[model samples]
Target: MKNNRNRQVVLKSRPADIPQAHDFEIVESDVPDLLDGQILVQNVFLSVEPAMRGWVSNVANYSEPVRIGEVMRSFAAGEVLQSSHSDFKPGDKVMGMFGWQEFAVVGPAAVTRKVQEDDLPLSLSLGVTGLNGITAYFGLLDIGRPRPGDTVVVSTAAGAVGSAAGQIAKLSGCRTVGIAGGSAKVAQCRELFGYDEAYDYKSDNLDLALGKACPRGIDLYFDNTGGVISDTVLRHLAVGARVVICGTASFPTWDPWPNGPRAERHLLVKRARMEGFVIFDYASRYEEAVSRLSQWIRDGRLRYSEDIQNGIECAPAAIAGLYRGENTGKRLIRIR
Candidate 1:
């Protein structure tokens, strides 16, 4: 078993709803041999993102769906165990699409970045200092441009992306309001994440809660979950409001296209602008975002939380936990 024990979680079948543990099979295989330009990386942490739900779904999406029997796609950070590439050497830390596996045989082209850990933790490459922060940076600043004193609202405000987006909006001089699922997360949003106001969307009267939180109506909205929560937010949008469609975490599938209230009339009356953004579109400018995020970290103007789970065995349930609101912040699998 030691000789052929590269344990990995592979998709056993397409999930009819949200993917569950039964849909994956963890199997052992021989560790891959190194090629001329490839390196062997032993993963340390695997990111549990909401986007993974869409990846495993049997429906159309912005990217190709993960085929059955393939290693589940994920972002991970790890150390190079062996290398045959000129750009990388053993002991170097890196982050990329390394999937839900213990060890990955990756070429130089597959490496997203060779991490430079000056005073930062390596796990952050998969969290705050990585895609989560980058998504918040561009999506809020570029699309949902919150002006000074403007009331900016964010859905899923305690999750990774939403937390960062709310904090960024607060730092930019906006009156930030966060909408989370429960009382615990709502408190975390206001106390820990620096949101000026927060409300529990699961409350009996969410419209009243939102109205009380944002008495001026919402000027900018960083929308992460697009369902009834968003439907309510749309009703209170200030004239010329800008909405950033970041994710639809509340929707399980889009095959039949889940129906909701129409937006044309709201946009027409409010003259609101809604735009969609994908982080990969700004890949060329990652350094720019990272620089600002790092500075914010250094200045103590930014803070983040991570809900880490140990062992590769816990990988299958991580995504489901994210959907169920079981995590308080960023969800990750620490594969030792």
Candidate 2:
């Protein structure tokens, strides 16, 4: 038996649809003792993000794929339980690329940040105020470039990244619209996320709803899911509109790459610009975004929520939940 010390989630199988519980297995293992610049962290919270599906898919992407039977990759926040690294210390709370496991042995190079436990919720360091928040800032403003009085629409608007993108667009003085999976999420978008308009993709005809809300036409569209949703938005783009492509959650099938409705005619008619961005490329500008978002959060200008599950044993389930739209806000599994 592989009798090590960490409780980790390993790939048990691949899925044809939303990942099921059986797709992963829990096992115990121990990391080797820390070397000169390494540290062992007892995970405090494991993040369950939508992009995890892409990471596990068979198709090649910007990064290498996670191999079958390997520990599932995740972004997590934890405490330094043991350390030999010059920068980290015992009792420090940090966020990094540590995957789904109770104990993570990571070197200094992978650590994204060390956080403080103050009035702000610590778990959020892994969510809205962390990567998701930063992603919304850069992906929406730097890429989508919503102009004042212009209309902006976001898919998966009630999700972590989508919700933040909508709110930030609203703050930028643009008319904000949202497309979410259910009525509950739609309500959250109009009320909680402060979207000027929101529609349930499950109930309302997306074309009709988007047409109604964006009568003036979409000036900026931030896409988290592609396929029909993107096609619908493409038909409504105003002249010179900017579209930021983030992810494609709608396509569950793992083909070689994404191909969808031909959008060239829409682009030509609107004279629009559409670009895809991987947030990791903006790593150097992360600090500036975090500082701005933190201020907005502190000034009662931001409203954020969370769906947190307890224990590392539930970590695999948490990651699978994002694909099925099981989480409300930022999905997290508490692992202390």
Who wins the lDDT comparison? 1
lDDT of 2 by residue, 109-203 (tens): 77888876356777888878889988999999899988899999999999888988998998899899999998899999988989999998878
Residue pair clashes in candidate 1:
none
Give the worst 10-residue stretch by lDDT in candidate 2. Answer: 1-10
Clashing residue pairs in candidate 2 (N, C-alpha, C atoms within 3 angstroms): 4-29, 4-30, 5-29, 5-30, 6-29
C-alpha RMSD between model 2 and the true structure: 2.3
Candidate 1 local lDDT, 184-278, one digit each (tens): 99999989998988888887488987888777788999999999999999999999999999999888888788998998888899999999999
Tell me how far the alpha carbon of residue 102 in candidate 1 is from the true structure, in angstroms, after superposition.
Answer: 0.6
Q: 237, model 1: CA deviation in Å?
A: 0.6
lDDT of each: 0.89, 0.84
TM-score of each: 0.97, 0.94
Over 4 Å off in model 1, which ranges? Answer: 1-4
